[model samples]
Target: MAKITYVNADGDSTIIDVANGDSVMRGAVLNGVKGIVAQCGGGASCGTCHVYVDPENTKPLADMHRVEDELLYFTACERKENSRLSCQLPVSEELDGLVVHLPEKQL
Candidate 1:
């Protein structure tokens, strides 16, 4: 299992142990973490699961897809260089202790 830390807009943090191969969005939704709407479930169609990967931990994540890259522009939050759709990030031993900061909203 990989331990992932989700930090909400207000700075509150929730840590969850995710099974290997689970997406970060699924892990957060399963753990009831607030701020992540995950409206499209695990699909890349919606950008509701947007998150900012800690700069120090971004290396382990897979490269962004063109669809995710395009959808991110529609997110309610400001998109940064580290912004990513959590559904695109798979949990793995390499991602243990990964930290993702949530945006102020997920509309």
Candidate 2:
């Protein structure tokens, strides 16, 4: 399992373990990690799972794809250079220490 850290807007953080092949959003939802709504259930269309990947850890994440890119435009919070949909980030052993920052809202 890969360990991922999720930091909320209020600065509270939780670390969850995710199995390989599972998306970051899945780990959060299953663990009850606050901040990621994941209303579309990992489908990439909802933008509800939007997160700001810690800049230092992004190298291990998948590159932004068209679907995520377009949906980001509809996020409920301000988009940043590190903005990404957690559902699009698959867990892997290489990403064991991945850290992502949750946006203020996901609607």
Candidate 3:
């Protein structure tokens, strides 16, 4: 299992324990973490599941696929180097204590 911390725009944090192979977006939705709408589920079609991964914790993540890369441009907030669609980020032991910063909105 891995523990992921999601920090909202206002600095509120929701920490969830997730199993390996579960997507970060799925973890948030399951735990009722705000700011992750996941409108398209884990399909990577909608950008509403956007999150800014802490730079230091990004090394373990797989490279973004073309679909997720393209969809990120449509997110509700400014895109950053650390920006990622939580739907595309699967959990793993290497990502324990991962920190994901939520955007101002996920609409």
Models 1 onward score TM values of 0.96, 0.96, 0.95
- Computed on alpha carbons, the lDDT of every model, listed in order, comes to 0.93, 0.92, 0.91
Worst 10 residues of 2 by lDDT: 55-64
Task: Compose the digit string of candidate 3's lDDT tens values, residues 34-76.
Answer: 8999988888988999999987775488789999899888898
Question: Who wins the TM-score comparison?
Answer: 1
Kindly indicate the candidate among 1 and 2 with the higher TM-score: 1
The TM-score, computed over Cα atoms with residue i paired to residue i, of candidate 3 is 0.95
Evaluation by TM-score, superior candidate among 1 and 3 = 1
Show where candidate 3 strays beyond 4 Å. Answer: none
Pairs in clash, predicted candidate 3: none
Q: Report the Cα RMSD per candidate.
A: 0.9, 0.9, 1.0
Model 2 off-target regions past 4 Å? none
When summed lDDT is taken over every stretch of 10 residues in candidate 3, the lowest stretch is: 54-63
Best by lDDT: 1
Summarize candidate 2's per-residue lDDT along 41-83 as a digit string, tens digits: 9998899999999988745778889989999999999988899
